[model samples]
Target: MKFVASLSAAAAALGALAMLPTTSAHGPETREEVVKFLDQQATAYHCAPAVAAYTAARKRSWAQKVLGGAPIADQNRFIDGYFEAKGLDGEVVKKGIKELEEEGKRIMACDPVVESKIRNSTCVLAPQSTEGPYYHTEAHPIRSNMAEWQLGLHFEMDVGVIDVETCEPVPNILVDLWHANATGHYAGHPEPAPHLRDEKPAASGLRRGLLSAYPRTNHVDTFLRGALPTDQNGVAHFVSTFPGYYTGRATHVHIKVHNEWSVLPNGSFTSGNLVHTGQFFFDDDLNESIDKLWPYNTNPIIALGRTRTRNWEDSLQIYQDAHDNGYMPTFDVEKIGGVLQDGLVGYITVGVNTSASYKPVWNPNSGRAGGVVEQKPIDKATHEEL
Candidate 1:
């Protein structure tokens, strides 16, 4: 909306906003201060129209559906049109590209061995991304009704997979998705009357996240968690509600990519390749709107206290880190607009290796690798895993 003001003037305005005074370390502490701060973020980030972003996202979604794993440029054509049509700020675009370039160079210069190990593992794919705080590989990995949470903004995403080795689209890859509900509670993580998992939104004054202090009943009721395979064009679509944020993280969606995964005779996932893992990000401006919405705002932290859900900064940093290590930032999430209710579409291309033979290492009590990442020896000269 206001953020997308005439692009011709956006360069000057972003320059001005960049020079604005920074907020204190943790962010606005009081409710009134939080509101004022978020309002400022909305203005500064140039909140785009939910309709425009959603529409652009929707068109891109359809294109992905029909074209499947089409080249990124094809999808960008549609995305760029949306930004152009909405008159997106040139400064935002310019700054994003510049940052990407610098990050790219940095990643390219990392130790080849370390970069190899990183890229071979989920850590390198999605910019400091991890797996198994809560993941269901057995029962509900391919589900689509994740929106059953029944609260907060509705969200859907279309993921495109590219084979970095071949520079081509990869099809039939299984994509796993999960995130916290509007209350910052993830499905299967445990909630006694979980919907009422914590303070009533009206009560205010609660703002913790998925830290160990929270219960993990593992109810496995299966909301906001599922998996789908990419079509011929390397695209997998999902249905979900906008995620709620917790302490130390922004609003995000965790995605895992599995190659050679297939539905067995009973329709359960059998083969697993655990190729990629990363999180999708949202526009800071639109997040301000989510802060004021029901349930999401009700998360004790936001309703009663402060907002732990910082915006794009952390994701950008992680992306930079991954790029420095010579890998892509999981995927590129093209945001269409800010309105959370009408729903928006997200698109990203994840690069995966079809020939990877690494076994996943999970969180072993002894600090051993157990999940998607494996412990490997690093060569100092190359700072790479040998």
Candidate 2:
């Protein structure tokens, strides 16, 4: 298998209690309340408008996840009392229910005609997580397509960005994505390799050029990893295959947002700030289906051969903890055709603070984390390598 791989500062009490209201001194009782609440809450959390929207709409432990967890009922009571104290009203209390109803309608009305439909889906703000041992910092360029692998069905994701500051779409931000291949292998990793490739990855032309360079691992196969900028509507459409499950983690994808970045004269990178770094997960049903499939069943680490298998291991408690904290976001999966081996679509919106700085360091040989490791190009005329 291939190796891969935030807290708001609210006081435990008052920060957990009120969190500055989205309504007004008078109260938000109409549709206009939507804009006001979104702006206010988004600004307070230093997140995106979509997050505020989901928090206000989902009406779950969002506050507890962000602020603190008392009890949902107790939290609601505190919120109502706090809203009353701040001069808000019932409309604000019921805003989340309305948002839920709207989301239900959208899910029921899913359409497949649009080639690049994602930002239009429901928005949810998620918790932040570390990139783990596998996040690479080498010079990988921005590209949209990531379906250059031999195994697994197609998985397309469209990332939507919400500018929490303006409660509007975040245009032109970079979306970085990376995941393991179906055989539980990551490109550029050199250890814990599979016993046999079945003459597959190479035979399929997927592991062609890079296989010879790095014999110890699949370091040359940069499959299922790429980056691209969001469009005007704050969206990036990506193509990839459903990833294979690896040891110590569940089925998930790693994401990072860079607000300002550029390639430099010396082949290095220059950037402005880190927008966001988080993950999106799949439905349990989807996970189970993948585990029971062909190449996924070939996962070198996981045992039991699919039946009764679950993604509940792999230092997985951290992810479960994040979900309990309400910082984890899940993609709305749409699997089409018989035997999920066909293809599917997953979507999620990331909220980010545009002002954060880019401070990242990659440690190769750090637990065999498989990701980008910079390599020098060879000079043809001089027969010299730099």
Q: Pick the candidate with the highest lDDT.
A: 1
True-vs-predicted CA distance for residue 92, candidate 1, Å: 32
**Top candidate (TM-score):** 1
Off by over 4 Å in 1: 1-128, 191-210, 213-215, 262-267, 311-340, 362-386
Encode model 1's per-residue lDDT on 67-112: one tens digit a residue.
4734324443442333332222334433433333333222223222
What C-alpha lDDT does candidate 1 achieve relative to the native structure? 0.49
Q: List the residue pairs that clash in candidate 2.
A: 2-184, 2-185, 48-164, 49-164, 57-96, 126-327, 127-327, 188-219, 248-314, 249-314
RMSD of 2: 16.7
lDDT of 1 at 376: 41
TM-score of 2: 0.55
Compute the lDDT for candidate 2. Answer: 0.48
Estimate the TM-score of every prediction: 0.57, 0.55
